[model samples]
Structure formats: structure tokens, C-alpha cells
Target chain A: MVIYGVALLSFCMLVGVFLGDLLGELIGVQANVGGVGIAMLLLILLSNLTSQRFSLAPMTESGIHFWSAMYIPIVVAMAARQNVVAAVSSGWMAIIAGVAAVAASFLLIPVLSKAGRGRPE
Target chain B: MSGDVLARVLTENSLIAAFVVVGALVMVSYWLSARLTRGHIHGSAVAIALGLLLAYAGGVATGGSKGLADIGVFAGIGIMGGAMFRDFAIVATAFGAELEALKKAGLVGALSVVIGVVLSFVVGALVALAFGYTDAVSVSTIGAGAATYIVGPVTGTALGASSEVVALSIAAGLTKSVLVMIGTPLVAGRIGLDNPHSAMIYGGLMGTTSGVAGGLAATDPKLVPYGAMTATFYTGVGCLLAPSVLYLVVRAVL
Candidate 1:
């Protein structure tokens, strides 16, 4: 079940990454350009448009949907590789100040969420 | 062959070894997620925390700039954790969402994105002022960094902030991203972030695309799109504000 789902995701990823890289090279950013977003669009297309043609099992469909949505292991990989030390060594003040700033933003989530409630237009 | 030869072999074929190392870490993280936190916390959160801890420690131990990726055996981490893979994972989330569901976010969702940008910027500016970055460029660059890493550079370039300051801003943004990723699931239940509306708000407020998506993924795979969609808006708003209106405000303040 997951195999087919992964195949679909992987197919999207390869094409997305390639196009993103090409776009980046064209734009001179030396990085992938909107590959993830492009791949996401492709995935949404396939998941929605081709579902009828494929007739995948419900578990397979959900499995594709599940990993498509979150997939935290990759997040961990990205987070783990960040150069926190380099950032820290640049300025202890920056790290401390940045933490305080982000913490404040975190605290404000509830206020914003509440302020936004009880209205539908 | 001896252990030396075995070590050399592993070092030479480091990509597979890196995957092995990461697989082991994820495996352990999930087990701890189940055993220690009883799955109240997702393995991704635990794994990210452990990753930060390990990377910080490893960076200090070797005094290397790239953290764990500096090690030969762990070198493939640069590829595994780099932007390409990160974006790849992020894009896949598109599959989970329905366009029609966006209607549910409504006006409040739009307001959240706008407010979330200013909210993060103001907090970052205040903190920057509190610290020793008394100059407008330094203060605003760091402040913009708090909005998101991308905004930091965009603002810095527009303001002509020194590259060192821009680097610091990037660092600041990276820190925020990690914080959001780890913090989301821990506070999701208490904050009533289970549904798509709240998820959109959370994404707007957090405004770091990767962090929001990752956190929401761990919390609820279905909610990733809502959070990421607004978080994308938040980035756009941050980019627009931090360089122009926000920069002028900082100049006036400092």
C-alpha cells in the first residue's frame, strides 16, 4: 500500500526537484527553485485526478495522504543539519534576543486565534 | 580486514552510513515517543530536539561550522538535511489538502496572516533593541530574521545591512523555524489547534513554512496544508513589511 504511495510521491519529488533546480539555475540563485511547491502541485493533481483511474486501496490512498501531509523525519533531518553553532558563535546576544523574539511570537498565537474567532463571511 | 579497514570502508561509502545513522536516530526517537511520552509527543519533535542537541554538541566538539555533517561518516547529512530534501518533503504535503477547504479559513485567516507578520516583526525588533544592536540596520535585520530566514536577507539587502548582520538574521530565523517545529505539537492540544481553522492561525502566527508544516505533520497530517498555506502568506507579508514599512519604523525608533 505504502509502496505505491511512496512511488507516487517519489515520482513527484524527482520531477519537482529537477524543475526547481533548472529554474534556480536559470534565475542564478544556485539553488532549487520552488521544487517542493511544484512537486506538491503535481501530487495534488495525481492524487485527485488519477485516483479513479488507479483504484488504489483505501489504506494506500490514506497512506499517500498521510505522508504527503506531514512526514516529520525529513524535518528532523533538515533541523539537525542547521549550523546552530555558527549562528551562536556569531553573537550570543543574537541567539538570546532571537529566542526572546520568537517566544513572544509563540505567545501571541492564542491572542490572534481568539481575536479571529466567531465570525464567518 | 581489521576495524581500521572497516571504518575506512564506511567512511568511503558514507551516504548509506548516513542513512543508517539517521534511520537509527528516527527509530530511537519514535520508540521514545511511544515509550517515554506515550506518543503525546510525536517522534519528529523528539527527533528534532535530539538532533539540535546532538548538532550543537557536535559542532562545539569539532568546532566545525556545518555541525554533524562535518564528520566524514555523517557527511551525507548535508544532502539529507539540505534545502532540496526539505523542500521536497514540504511539497509532498500538497497531496493532503483540498482547495475547497480553504474557504473555511475566511476573513480571520487573512487577518491572521497580516497580523502574524507584524506581530513577529515587532517582537523581534523589541528584542533586538533590548540587546546591543542599537543601530537601525542591525536591529531591523535581526528583527526581520525573526519573521523568517528568507525575509532576513531580503530586508538586509534592501537596507544595506552588513553581511555579518544578515548572517545573524539568518541564524535568528533558523532558530525560530526549529522552535516552531518542536513547539507546535507540544502545545497543540492546549491551544485548540486540532482543526483546520486553528491550524491556519497557527501557521500564520508561526510563519516559518518548514517548521509549521513539520509540526502540523506530527500533530495531524491533514492540517499541514492549512498551516503551510498561511505560513506562505506570512512569509510574503514578512518580506513586504520588513524591508519597507518596518525598516522605516526602525529607523525612526533608533
Candidate 2:
């Protein structure tokens, strides 16, 4: 039952990656175009569809949860490493952009807070 | 099998081995965060710092283009860290969200996302300008990064920005994520960031899902779901806006 969930996930990923690659080619870019995002969207749709049509076994449900929990940490670790390598080699502009974004976001807090105050809840 | 055969097997499975190594590193990072920062700083931030340090070291040691992947054993990192997993994680997070709760945020949540994306893009573009990046693609890509790290590369790639600029955009997003993780708890009380409504608004205003998730977890664990729900939409809104509307705006300005 758990294996079914994984199979489903894998299926979604395959299609998603294919579409992403196709999108990239069509756009004249040499990279995958939101392949993972596409896969996840597919998964969400399929899972919701399946759940409504037929209840998932608890084991299958748990299997999905296990993978989902692992997803963020593993992805973050991998992405962060790649980003650092890219930033270090890209000269000072990257660092400046990063710092500026963070600083500006901090400045925005006051403005956002003030704007948010109108809502009573 | 002989020792040579065993070595060859290990080399062939280097990618799996790399995952193990990364997992260990994550544990160490969490331990360091707990011990050193007393958990004030999220473990994700620490893990990222350590990851960056390792990446730099790997790059220096091998002089290879793929960072640690240049080394024989770490080559799997290239695949593991690729967009496939990144997008999968993002999409999977959405599966658990309840749609009805999202509707509860209503007009305010939608407004926050619009305002948040535009404001962040403007700030990012200004930073790009300040750094002598005069081109619209580069400026908009970086601005999108301010929207969220996910948006940065997506916009950059779509607009044909140099890989270096795209990388810079990611760095910009990462920096914002780390800061939000550390700053949210400190400012939570003062800014009235305690309730679910406020958390949803906060998530909309701050488009970085990881940052918002980590920050909310620190501030109030209960609010994590609410914050992450709207934060997910923020990314979607950003992805839609960055390359289209915001890019057009930047192009028109320059």
C-alpha cells in the first residue's frame, strides 16, 4: 500500500520533469522549467482526486507524510549548497543583492505593520 | 570481493553516500544551533551556513565547476540538489494544506501577497541598481529573488539572465530567509504577530516559505500551518508576477 503512494509520486515526477524540460526547450532556455513545481502540482491533484474517489489506506497515507517531511530538509540542504557555490563565484553583486534584500525586508516591517493595523483580527 | 572491488562499489554509490554525509551535516548543524544559539536561530540557517562553508571548501579543493560534485564522491550532490527535488518539496507541502482555511484569510491575505511581491521586487531592483546592474533582466531577476528564492531562478532563467545573476538572486533570497528566521521571534510580540489572522498576513507579506515557516515555528508553533498556507500562495503569486508584471515594470523604468 505504501509502495503505491511512492509509485504515484514517482509517476507525477516523471511527467512533471518531462513537461518542465519541454517548457525549457520551447522557451529557448537550456534548463528545466519548474519541473518539480509541476510534479508537485500533479501530485496534489492526483492525491486529492484519489482521496475523494477512494480512501487511502493508513499506511499509504503515512508513506506520503514521511516523504513530505523529508522533502523540505533535503531540498533546502541541497539548494543552499548550490547557491553558496554560485554566490561565491559570481563576484560581489550577489552578496550585495542578498544583503540589500534582507535589509529592505527589515525596513518593510514597520510599513507592513502599520498597514496591517487597520484589520482588527 | 577484493578491496579494489569494494572501493569501486563505494565510488559508484557515491551519490547515496553523499546523502548520508549531508544528513550527518544537518544533524551537526541542528546540534550547533541548539547549543550555540539556544535555538533562537533556526537550525535551517545553521545548516545553510555549514553547507555554504562545505561548498566553498569543495570548490577550492577541486577547482571544479560543480563545487563538491567535482570530487568523485560528492557528484551525487548535483542530482540531489537539483530542481527536481526542490520543486517536489514545494509542491508536496501544498498537499497537507486545507483550502477552506486559506479562504478565511480573505481579501486581506490577497492584498498582502500583492503588496508583498511588489514591494520586495522594488527593493531588489533598487539593490541591483545600486550594485551597477543596469540591465532589466538582471534587476528583475534579483527583485524576484527578494520575492522568494524559488522565484529568483525561475525569473532569471525565463528572462535569460546570466547564471551568475541568477545565483546572486538565490543568494539574495537565502539571505532574506536566514534573517527572517532569526528576526521573527524577536519582533513577533511587538508587531502583534501572534494570531492566525496575523500569521496568514505575515506569510503573505513575507514570501519566503522557509523563512516564514521557521520564524513562525519559533514564535508560535501553532501558527506554522497558517503562515505556511498563505506563504505558499505568495510563491505562486510571485512566480506569476516576477517575470511578467514586475519584469515589465522594471523594463519600462529602465
Candidate 3:
């Protein structure tokens, strides 16, 4: 059954990606099926790498791989526009964002740690 | 193309000498970073410094031969971060006063990452709308790719969205990649997510938002080449069989 489940999950993800293109075409949603496909491929590779020990449950890695692939290609497509990026690129922006991410990581990680206290899942 | 760039720079500028100089600096940096850590983490500063040395050496040695050295620098960065993560985790596990505290911290770290992604996207989109700007998507996409490829791709997925929401998904992706480049050693020093597989998974999560953000930023043909690979790789797994398993679990729990 586990084998069947893994096999079935693999098949469906592949088909969904291929079919997602057709669905996008039909629905006129402009979904980058190729990008989605790429996300899926990367996720599968990731799941395979990490799922051995930290896989909270069977197929957890696989499942996260599936859902995560859904949104990434869209982000990539947006990045392709060089002209637009050139107009807004700034040293300050980079500095600010870098600072912000670090600050946020420092502040939020610890806070979240505190909040999660006394709560057992 | 990257190889040619390196070769041209090396030949035209006599960069080999620079390599030796930088290699020495990197060694010193490694020693210093290690000393600074004071056993909080181990081997990271040295590893990063070594990696930097190797990068310079590798780049010079390979002379852009198949661009393997360039790729190694990126991988080395990720490996360093993974090593750091492993070190930190081990310390947390060994030294943590409460097992629950460690678990909570991990959960918090994960959630903050998620929240950060969403907020980044919101900021990105708003900036895009207000200034009538674009192009950061590529930065984010590439950033995320660098992150995931180096760390495992999951981290890229998680942080990718932060860039997307703010319309800097590509930058975010690239940032993650750079972070992997720089942070790997630091993270490795303090904690060790020593497992490459786990690192890759984390990389994927980091890249995910970047992918989404990249797609949202534009509908460009050129971006897809860089942007789509990570998305396709991660989502392809989903298409294969992963989602259904998730569905079953949700169903069972519900």
C-alpha cells in the first residue's frame, strides 16, 4: 500500500503539471505550467534528500513538495523582466531589504519560540 | 558564458595573483570566524574561509573549465550553512534545557520564515503597483534558485515568496542564494543541519515563495529559463504522487 501510494502520488503530480498547461489554456489563466513543472521537479529532489529523518509522517515531504511547487514558477516568470528591474534597482533597496530580513529573522524567530511555549501539539 | 567571463577577467587582469592573495585572506577569515564563535559553533568559520579559498583556487584552477569551480563556490556556501545548522541543532538538542523549547524554536523559525515570505510579497506587490516597477522578480527567482540548489531548495521555496510579495522575489531568491553562500558557514558553525537532504528540503521551502513571486512579477519569456527550473522540479514531485498523500492525511484528520 505504501508503494502504491508513492507511485500513485508520483504519477498524479506529473500528470497534473502536464495537464495544468491544458487547463490554463482552457481557462485562460496564464498559468506557467512549465514553471510549475520545474517547481515540482525541485521539490521532489528536495523531499528525497530530507525526508529520511525529519519526515513527520509518511509522505510528508512528498506532500509539501506538491503544494510548494504550485506557486514558484509564477515568481520566476515575473523575474524575467530585466528592463523593469533596471529602472528600480538601488543600493539602498538592497541594503534595506537585507537589514530587514535579518532583523525580522532575529526578532520573529525568538518571539515565535516564546509563543509556542506551553502549547503541545 | 560564465566561464568565458572568468577566463577573460583572469587573463586580462592577472587575477591568479589575486587568487593567492584572496586565498590567504580567506584562511585568516576562517580562523577568525572560528575564534569568534568560541565553541558556540564549530568548524564553520574555517570551512567558509576554506570554501572561499577553494572558490578562488577552483576558479583559477578550473580556468572556467566547464564552470565547475564557479558552481563549487555556490555549493560550498550551501554546505557550510548546512554544517552550521547541524552544529546548532546538535547544540540545541544536547544543551537545550527543555526538549519542548527546541521544538518550539524550530517551529517558530519555520513559521516566521513563512510569514516573512508573505509580507515580502505584499510589500513587493505594493511597491510594484505604486512605483510602476518590475524586474526584481528575476533577482528573486535567481536568488531562490541559488538558495535551493545550494541548501536543498526548500529554503528557497519558503523565502522565495517574501521576495514575490514585495515584487523582489528574484532578488529574494538571489538573496537566499547569497545567504546560502555566506550564511551556510555561519549556520554550520553554530548548528549543523548536516544532512544535505534536509538542507535541500529547506532550500526548496525557501525557494517556493521566490518562484511564486517570480511568476507574479511578470510574464516574460527570458525569465522562465532561470525561474521555471526550480518551480518545475518541486512541482513535478507534486504531480507525481505527493498531493494525494497529503489529501488522505487531511481527510483522515478531518
DockQ numbers for every candidate? 0.42, 0.31, 0.07
Q: Candidate 3, residues B122-144: lDDT per residue as tens digits?
A: 33333333344443432333222
The best candidate by TM-score is: 1
lDDT of 2 at B77: 71
Question: What would the TM-scores of all predictions be?
Answer: 0.81, 0.69, 0.34
Ranking by lDDT: 1, 2, 3
Write the residue-wise lDDT of candidate 2 on B31-126 in tens digits.
Answer: 998999999766765665565567667778877545565667676777665545544544545556555555556566667778888888888888
After superposition, the stretches of candidate 3 with alpha carbons farther than 4 Å from their true spots are A1-99, A118-121, B1-41, B49-113, B123-171, B180-254
Off by over 4 Å in 1: A1-42, A51-70, A87-92, A115-117
Query: Over the true interface residues, superposed, what is the Cα RMSD of model 1?
Result: 3.8
lDDT of 2 by residue, A1-45 (tens): 888766777787789778867876675544455455466557767
RMSD to true structure for each model, in Å? 4.1, 5.3, 15.6
lDDT by residue for model 1 (B153-202), tens: 87888789999889888888877776676677777877888887788778
Clashing pairs in 1: none
Position A23, candidate 3: lDDT: 56
Cα error, residue A97 of model 2, in Å, equals: 2.7
For model 2 the TM-score comes to 0.69
The list of candidate 2 runs beyond 4 A from truth reads A10-54, A88-93, A106-121, B1-7, B33-45, B64-67, B106-113, B131-254
